[model samples]
Target: MDLQLQGKVAIVTGASKGIGFYTALQLVKEGAHVTICARGEKYLEVAAASIKQQTGADVLAVPADVTKEQDCQAVIEKTIAHYGKLDILVNNAGTAAAHPFEQVATALWQTDLDVKLFGAIHCAKYAIPHMKQAGGGSIVNITAVLAKTPPASSLPTTVSRAAGLALTKAMSNDLGAYNIRVNAVCIGLIRSDQIEKCWQAQAPQLSWEEYSEQVGQSIPLGRIGSTEEAANVITFLVSDAASYVTGTTVNIDGGAGSAL
Candidate 1:
């Protein structure tokens, strides 16, 4: 049952909560030293503390906005400083705005690309060397189904995420020669903090549970997926179990995203 990940070093950007938090927890459980990052210093610290307290695993908490190149490089440097090497990189930091495409302003569109697309580029640029030093590693970019499904409201998110998928494949094509496997997972709706924020702001009249169910029913699976569910597939893609998997996107949408 060992993933052969013991002692491996990983960086999970936007790990303050949600899927990143669960992904980091799962990696630590499998014995990987994880570095978590987010923009909010206080919340990032708290997330690190909570994960450490629960798992008794080594961790580095860095407050860095993924959109900033300097912040992205700082995460890689700090991870190497603590763990001496990087074996896995999870580019998970991103934001989604549920606005119609017709209404999306130029500024909003620019912001989406800045965070989702460019952020992945910056992190991978720095992490590749450390990964190359390790003789090869895995890079998992956490994308969303909107990339394929094309959500009606979240136009910017759909476009940005689709761009991320392209980045994943392109990175895989280039990094393959170096033995660094790069892949992306097109995530479906899950119980993440960002979704919670969106729901509360949009549907203030509905209780959290009501709002969750309303969204869940729309998914083909009849419920929203758990972060752990999404992380397991991601974990497999990064682990030795998926050694041959690269330049591919595994969609975990509960059949909601029947993308042609």
Candidate 2:
């Protein structure tokens, strides 16, 4: 099951922790050189060090806010400067808080779009050229199940993810001629730092195992997903094994999303 990913250069955003960190780590495991970025410098450095220690792969940690155009540009610039070519771009930056439409503030909506939608746009805008120059590349946007099935009280996240899905499709069509492939992975309830924080803040009495079981009951698979599970799919999408896969949104939910 060779992914044919040796020496491929990749950039993964929001890789300081959680799914992003796992994705970058798995890419390195599959023999890819990865540049991981996040807004938090401390966590980014620590993550890079851990990945290097664990995988013995070339890992560069860049601290940049995805919401800013300059930051996104810097990420691409530094990646090329370090690796000399780009093969994969995983736009996994922002997370939007859930709220009802009436309760959603204008500021909140704008900020969500800035981090999720515009963040991908800025990264792709710069990465596309390098991808084209390299003759081809893969781009994976880490969206959510809410993009296709919007539950009540899910405001900006659903809207933002829908935009991301659309972007994935549109980019696939536009870049196919250049041999560039674009796709997305729609997430569900996966264990992560953010999810753990929310659980702790809301249910201080529940241990992680207890809370996870309670949450998994609602999903058809009877358990939440793992970071490695999501990362495996992403790594595949970026590999030669998935050379024919593009413009598709694959749901990594544990059968939680209603739509196909």
Candidate 2 whole-model C-alpha lDDT, 0 to 1: 0.93
lDDT of each: 0.88, 0.93
Name the candidate that leads on TM-score.
2
TM-scores, each model vs. reference: 0.92, 0.95
Give one digit per residue, the lDDT tens place, for model 1 in 144-192.
Answer: 8878878578778889999998898988999999999999999887887
The digit string of per-residue lDDT tens for model 2 on 1-260 reads: 99999999999999989899999999999989999999999999999989989987669889999999999999999999999999999999987688989999999999999999999999999999999999999999999998898989999999999999999999999999999999999999898887888888988798877787788998998877889999999999989999999999999999988998
Candidate 1 has an lDDT of: 0.88
Model 2 stretches with alpha carbons more than 4 Å out: 198-210
Best by lDDT: 2
- lDDT value, residue 133 of candidate 2: 100
Error of 2 at 138 (Å): 0.2
